[model samples]
Target: MDALTRRSFICGGAALAAMATMPAVAATGVKTLKNGKTTVDLVANKVLAQVGGVLELTIKKYGKVAVVRTSKGVKGFSVINLACPHAFVTVKRSGNGWVCSPPGHGSEFLLNGKLKVPPATTDLKAIKFTANSKLLTID
Candidate 1:
């Protein structure tokens, strides 16, 4: 085996550090109704009460999705498909946004699903939803 170079070691460490910052919060309080709508209980997923919080889940109709808190009001949440528009690979939370990692072409999107980098010609797909004080219903 070849000896490890200092440059390679530093690069490897940097890559690991970047990956470590990605959020991996699981979906909480998810309930599928008989009528086919899905509901998330804000009380059970308290992280979503704060701005910038994200609750990731999968919907039967939409596949992977994220519910992001953009502001403090009841209407401040954004529901977006997590699949990268470029390659349809699920994006991972990175810093203040999302990144289309391996198997994708490195498309980037803001927390609200706005396109920030390309390879993707559009923003992440938005899903319709309604929110009240306690629950957010995905329609």
Candidate 2:
């Protein structure tokens, strides 16, 4: 093997740092109802216990979606589609929000799916949902 060069070492370190900063996508348990709605048990999804936590999951009705904890109440959450409105490309989590990746034109959205930057004029599509003390049901 070749000896490690200063340039290679610096580049490697930078790459590792980038990877470390990338957001981790967590999958939450889901239940599909006979009425075609989807349900998530709030207690089972520990992440939502804290504000700003997010759970990513695939729904039959909405390709990819994220359920975000916005505050501390039954109404303090948001469920949004992951597809970028610009090109229908899937946006990935970056920093405290989402960034439209390549194959897309670099739109950005807040964690709650609010539009931050454009190429995309709208926020991520919000899916109708209702929450109780123990469950969140997506309509």
Candidate 3:
């Protein structure tokens, strides 16, 4: 492995320090739906019209949810929360996954909400959803 540079070290240290002191985010403005059988009309959701498209939905009790059209034959969609489990910061889409870079703390998670990098020990919270034809019923 390559040795860490001084600049990289300093930046890393700063990010970690920020992560340690960052507070949980205040209430989100997005109105989340109830955690029950909530139906999402695919036809109405233009973003999900194409395969590989990702739709971010907000639930009443839950936080931001990332709903993606999966290419895998097993299922058509995968849904997960967008908040970083470690810092409560909203994660941004990074390549094929989600990444949280709040100050010094850096974390990455797969689209399916699996942890791909650390500073985050746990995977993102999964939101259960069932797809039928063009509609998805989330629980």
Candidate 4:
């Protein structure tokens, strides 16, 4: 309505937006395996976790996700997209169903998100998980 009011409003709006994008992400999902695809459709507040069992989930909203159940009853999870972050180019997908691309220099990572190749020293970002009851909640 006024100059000062407008400036304050704009600043407040910008801060709120920036905060939203900061990836303070909270997420939750339920998964079902179908045709080799584990579809994850749920709220961000729900977490993906290992609750004495395992689940494989593919989250469409972010990218492709992978989960594994260990022999010791442990669960592992990761997020991957074959699209290179630098150029948005499609990277080679591995037999393990992992995206093989690096952000900066030419480095490679394992499907489990471990660092492999060099020149780039970055690993894949992990998909956070939490557990409640028998549910594996991924965020």
Stretches of model 4 off by over 4 angstroms after superposition: 1-60, 75-106
lDDT of 4 by residue, 71-128 (tens): 2322433444444443343433343323333222334456555656543355555656
Model 2, residue pairs in steric clash: none
- Ranked candidates (TM-score, high to low): 1, 2, 3, 4
Q: What tens-digit string does per-residue lDDT give for candidate 1 at 51-108?
A: 9999899899999999999999999999999999888989877778888766556677
Give the alpha carbon lDDT tens digit for every residue of 86-138 in model 3.
Answer: 97987766556777754425687886779998889999888887777667777
lDDT score for candidate 4 against the true structure:
0.42
Whole-model lDDT values for every prediction: 0.87, 0.85, 0.69, 0.42
- Clashing residue pairs in candidate 4 are 26-44, 27-44, 27-46, 28-46, 47-137, 47-138, 48-137, 48-138, 49-136, 49-137
lDDT of 2 by residue, 24-75 (tens): 7565668999999999989888988999899989899899999999999999
Error of 3 at 53 (Å): 1.3
Task: Name the candidate that leads on TM-score.
Answer: 1
In model 3, where is the ten-residue run with the lowest total lDDT? 23-32
For candidate 3, give the lDDT of residue 25.
30
Q: Which prediction has more favorable TM-score, 3 or 4?
A: 3
